[model samples]
Target: MKSTINTSQLITLPDGRSLEYIEYGDCSGTPVLYNHGMPGSAFEAQVLNDVFKDNGLRVICPNRPGIGRSSSLSEYSLSQITQDCFFLLESLAFNKVTVIGWSSGGVPSLWQAKHSHTQISQVILLSSYSHFAELDQAPSHFAGQASVLKQVTTRFPALGLLACKMAGYLLKYMPSLYFKLLMQHCHTPDSDIIEAHPHYRDMLIEAQKQSISQSASTLFMDLLIQFREWPFYLKSIECPVTVFQGDRDPFVPERIGQHLADCLPNAQYHLLPGQGHMYWFEKSFQYRLARLCQI
Candidate 1:
């Protein structure tokens, strides 16, 4: 398939589920697969796509199951999302991939190392927690923490849409106001030069998993089953693993990331001071990515 700037390509999972993926740059070049954080859409890949376009690498970012256009299954788990990624790559004729997973996407990246290490040259996990205890260190701002509040309105599966509809309105409207006030909390803002775009957040709400209630419940379930101790089953992986963390990441703390890097058999960890969990859009992040991938 030819690469397009912002175009999305559809790929089907073995279960006949259609997943949404975006590709950028030359298809024949070294393929770098991107996995985004939870409740995030592939739109988040846009910045990185533009930055790495001429770097002789093909970038691919896919929407996870139950997010965006991807089909959701009742039996979905973090491990299964990893397997789904494996088949998606195979279906797309991706023989080998250098994976860069962010935040929640790190779970599937570990899954890749565990089950498909032979097909991956290098693995990168960014701003992700390797253990359940790490959750305690997450800043109060992570929306996943608010997922429980969203789920309370949808206790009954049948009336899920109503709850979702209500939650969506609040999330869509509140974030804008919050960002305005909280911009100073993290970094100094240059409103004149940079107009912040919450495009991915908009796309997330417009997804087929449109119901905030359902998505929250599904994530709640994933956290319940996964998000702890790197699953230990990831022992088979021998590839060089790189864990990226930000000094002030609201979701990932330094100690937790250090623990994860120490646990990996062959791993290198990089700490980006003054950067937060969403490092993809930062200029400093681009340089770090270049250095990490040796582009």
Candidate 2:
């Protein structure tokens, strides 16, 4: 179970399902469980690969159900995902960890702080949301191919699955154009960053392809649940929490991050002005993330 930089493995859970994960950083360093965003897979955790190693941190990036190599679940709540995380850590002999959630991943990250705080030292949310209702404020901002998929999946389950299947087909056969439209719709800052760093865009496409190929149901279910009311409230969580968001991130507005921070009794909010949703791709941001976890 020793960690190795950029190594991938699969652990079988008690329910006969497998959890796939990729590890980076020092094998014996403080364990940091990273939760990736929507339509993203474990590979997204490698954004700060070198920073984690330099900071003496062990980062574990696991694929949620129906994503990557992980098995799918027909119906599961956000809390159930938290339980999956606990089992994954226990199997690896990790009693406690620092949980870091990015974007949609933040839902379970908050849940961990509330339901599994006993085994969580700290919680961090990057461009994340505290509730689904927050998205109502900027519906136009989320209008895109992504929004179409969500709407289809939520309103017509059968059609949603078909849409995911077709999308997956396109991603596999026509990846370049698929990513082209994706980046074309991105905010100026986000698109600029991705253009400057081709690898980031490539990573995104690869991860997304893997996600849809595995089982689009998981992605659809995630989006559907995200549109409804979350089970827990931010004010109820007592663990130390930190929220980082880009001031110009329309999908997860700066105000939403600030609002979540305000509701949490022990939380701090850091807004990166002018930056878009993918500010975490910056080295400086990665360094700050490492420092925050270590502290």
Candidate 3:
């Protein structure tokens, strides 16, 4: 399927950076900004294209700095990331918006809520982790891959970057094999969902290619920052927020979601019995979100 993004809509930032974003759904509908996960790009929005369109929602998915066509940032911080998003929204003539984050994408969504509560109508996190520091006690199987990377990156930055390069290269150049291995690591619920809906797998592969093709370092940078301590606290966010977690998620434990829900000043936690990390890609996701939006 053709992408919903218009190249003509690309905007230049004050720092000479480019903000590449794609629009989906009704042109005159309510606005929502989707913050994609690590190793993702604006193309990630394609997975939810039909959902947004049917709901009469205007969705904007942007490629973060160092990903896709956007310029790389020398320094990375959650605060700066939120500010950049604010600038992009303002430039697009949008003020109030619903922000949705998935996986690692939750970092920015939470930061945006903390920094610009008045501008954000609501915040939603899908299979997200609260922070890396607090994940010490999470499942060892889930932390194993990340822990190795964090350790290597802390000890040898060059080697860490090379590892990321190799991983991204495999993802972009050898996607079929890469995804096969990736599926092996997923929980049963997520694997079943992907196996049933082959198109969803294609979407993930394409998003990875789009992101890595632009900058292999982008994923590495995201990982480095993800392991460090976050600048803000979950309790600081006063906006209406909801966290959707899957009981079978292997990447992020259910306990993390429950803890975050407990911490957020105003947040609700919804747990799905047999779902997993990729539940957001399911067709029924739109209806679930619609029901929540009505509340």
State which candidate has the highest lDDT: 2
lDDT tens per residue, model 2, 1-295: 3446787799988888888999888778889999888878889877877888888899989888888888888685776677889898888888778899988888878877888746898899998866645444533435334355556766788997676666677788998988887666668999888878889978888888778766666666776776567666667889899889888775777766876777789998888889888988888888989998888
1-295 in candidate 3: lDDT tens per residue?
Answer: 2224334257788888777788876667678888988777777777766666667677888878877777778885566677789998898789789999888888788878888946788999997757666565445424434456667876688998997798787896788898988888798989888888888888888887876776778787776777777766677788989999888877776877877787788998999998878988777887687555534
TM-score sort, best first: 3, 2, 1
Model 3 residue runs over 4 Å out of place are: 1-8, 134-159
Candidate 1 has which clashing residue pairs, if any?
none
Q: How many backbone clashes does candidate 2 have?
A: 0
lDDT score of residue 278 within candidate 1: 63
Compared with the true structure, the alpha-carbon lDDT of candidate 1 equals 0.63
Worst 10-residue stretch by lDDT in candidate 1? Answer: 185-194
Tens-digit lDDT string for candidate 1 (1-295): 4454568778777778888787765565677888776545566666676556656567788877666667777786767778878887887788878888777677777777777746787888887656443433545423332234323433443354444454455555575553454344444322321346455334434432332333655544444444434455433568889888777654555665776676678888888777666666665566567556643
Q: Residue pairs in steric clash, candidate 2?
A: none
- Runs of candidate 2 with Cα error greater than 4 angstroms are 1-3, 133-163
* Cα-based TM-score, every candidate: 0.75, 0.89, 0.89
Q: Of models 2 and 3, which has the larger TM-score?
A: 3
The Cα local distance difference test for each model comes to: 0.63, 0.79, 0.77
- Candidate 1 — which residues are off by over 4 angstroms? 1-5, 133-167, 173-175, 178-215, 228-236
